[model samples]
Target: MSFPKYPEYKDSGVEWLGEVPAHWGVKQLKYLVTCLDGQRIPLNGVERYSKQGSVPYWGANKIMDYVDEAIFDEELVLLGEDGAPFFDVGKPVAFHSSGPVWPNNHIHVLRPGDSAWVKSIVYGLNATNYIDFVEGSTRDKLTQSRMMSIPLAWPPHDERNHIDSFLDHETARIDALVEEQQRLIELLKEKRQAVISHAVTKGLDPDVPMKDSGVEWLGEVPAHWNVVKFKYLIAEFEQGWSPQCDGDQAETLDEWGVLKVGCVNYGVFDPTENKRLPDNLEPRPELSIRKDDLLISRANTRDLVGSAAHVPMDYPKLMASDKIFVVRLHQRICRSRYAVVYLFGKGVRHQIELQATGASSSMLNIGQGAIRELWIPLPPDSEQDRIVHELEKREADFAALEQETVRHMRILNERRSALISAAVTGKIDVRGWQADQQSRQSEILMAAETRATYG
Candidate 1:
């Protein structure tokens, strides 16, 4: 997996460039490419919507939409002028696009002097450290002058082609592996949701007698189970107060903080998603969060409205916001964990979405009355405990698998970035590199065997 270093090296005079192969030449980026920023035209959302068509409308980082007109029709590289992930080394700052496309003013367009060098230039720009060149307080901006003055190391024409070919082949392989891991993570999420939905709606006993619950969505529950409105199990519920707070989160437990709606957006409590209360405002001790407190987001996007989470522990300094509701369940009739599982089920989620209302799609609110009217199937207290324990075990297993897959993806992405930096900077020589035919054949055979076994 390790590459060979250059046989001879020479200082490039530039610190970031460091050293290059003895035979390589170094020059500023302006001399190697022509800036085509003047050709870019900016389009607003409404204008683009009216002119929707086949051509891509590019923003700083990605395609924002498709428009009816084309601006440039040649091979070129587009670099983010602002709003790009310049500090994230694993992300790309520049990308190559061909054929007809319309780029917005937020991107800087460049046409390489040599058509063959388009891809190589993209890799080189992406690998460079932009910390010293970018500016701006809110968003990093790569000015045209700073971009043009970037130092670059280049090899002979034929060697540049070889480097491009080597990188294209190797990066594609790493990307494929990353994609497989991503797909596995998504599948695990689907499986986890399915397991929760089935367990909460139907008892673990498959042969249990079934009876109509009168409610269409409740369907047929176990003969002994009772289908009742959510209000029956809720002993009490209260909305919190919102005070103007600092933009940053409370750094220490001693500092008072107000929870944001996003604290339970994913159905898990995130204590860190809070804003610090200003010194001028008095803390409300009565609204302080307590252990096992059930919190639900009262206002959020439609999909996240009515999202709920059970506070695992107490945070005396943290209080719920006006957009959140704190609910206390009747412990004798329902277990907190069991109620959470039922609320997260697909059937209950559908009801929440249907009842939510707002002026805009981005912000929706669910009223307390709507939440109380939602139906839930109730089981014996002992049966509720059993279901929660089984679900906890399954969730642990799924979490471990997902964490491992995500870690593997991180490693692959880091390897890819390192390889590109080494090759483009002449730290490694790739002029003699070629795709390994035998290794590729072995991979194909292994993939086929896996499909056969799984199918």
Candidate 2:
């Protein structure tokens, strides 16, 4: 949908905002709003908890955590002072927070002197590009004085409320649809996981006689299958060495690189996660990744501690880091591709969780003993090969569907951002525009129904 431009425009004397409706007024942000800088609490002072509290602790980004208490109890807007980038339209830099928010020093809390300006200020800040006003090298910082000096485009108070109401309704609808698409993607992922779990744990022969696998996650297997400790199938397994190197430099094509833990985190090989080796260091050639090699993450969050992936491509000079382990398997005993599926499957995942050792608050690590000792229900090599082939074929269609759903979600989010920016910036007048949009939507729905009936 397109919006007509406002009639009779005048120069606003601001470069970013070229022109505005003739009747609109321009004011510096400082004069139009009240800055409550004194009300902020430091992050360390703000007690953090996991879903155990009532009050929201608003930081530079979304609610960083929920605490036991509230510092302020009224509705206000919070803009990032640093840490959060303003260029991202998807995650807005300004937040319209309400009801018992404990704001931190990383953001500026503001209340409009006129209650009517509340939503307008939020919309403007979110739409405005703020790279000009921020300071600091690592993280951009928006200083209080710079924020106060910024010019804001202001319309009539009543018109401000009208624009606010229009955006609130439209963005909410767009957000709900985006949420639906997101839920669909999650469902697709779960379906993909189920396919892998079934094919790897239970062979393609459903009518075959079954026996107890003795593993809780793998309840039953084909009668001929045997459950054995992982050590029996592995020739050897060991974590790789790490050499000190600056991580930000470009990687040389044929030089040594140390793989980060994320390479196997998502059940795929992500070669881009490696760091370039320093010229002074020499890496052992035995550690270099070869075609058909298997790798697993030794240290990660407990949920992903034992994640494994098969390397389908060979690399010249890449070796694993200490956080990841290279697996040398006896192929006669177990198929490599089958091993990938079983390690990431539901039942074996639980075993990995049980074996992972670390303080509850930190990253979990699985020892060589645990990886070797964990039991697996195995089929013969030929059956393993068949299972892998069937799963890959079944997942191909679901993966395509998931990719398409993700593209649709991205388009919806882009539309949401464009709609909000247009309504707030007076590029379009939204007063009573809600009813017009509703009518147009009804017409489109009616047209679709009429087409379906005729065909």
Top candidate (TM-score): 2
Model 2 / residue 268 / CA error / Å: 0.8
**If scored against the real structure, what TM-score would every candidate get?**
0.80, 0.83
**Model 1, range 220-254, lDDT digits (tens) per residue?**
88999988888988887989889998888998999
RMSD per model, one decimal: 6.3, 5.5
Per-residue C-alpha lDDT of model 2 across residues 369-447, encoded as one tens digit per residue: 8788878888999999998888888778988998899887776666666666666656666564664455453332222
lDDT of each: 0.84, 0.77
Clashing pairs in 1: none
Inter-residue clash pairs, candidate 2: none
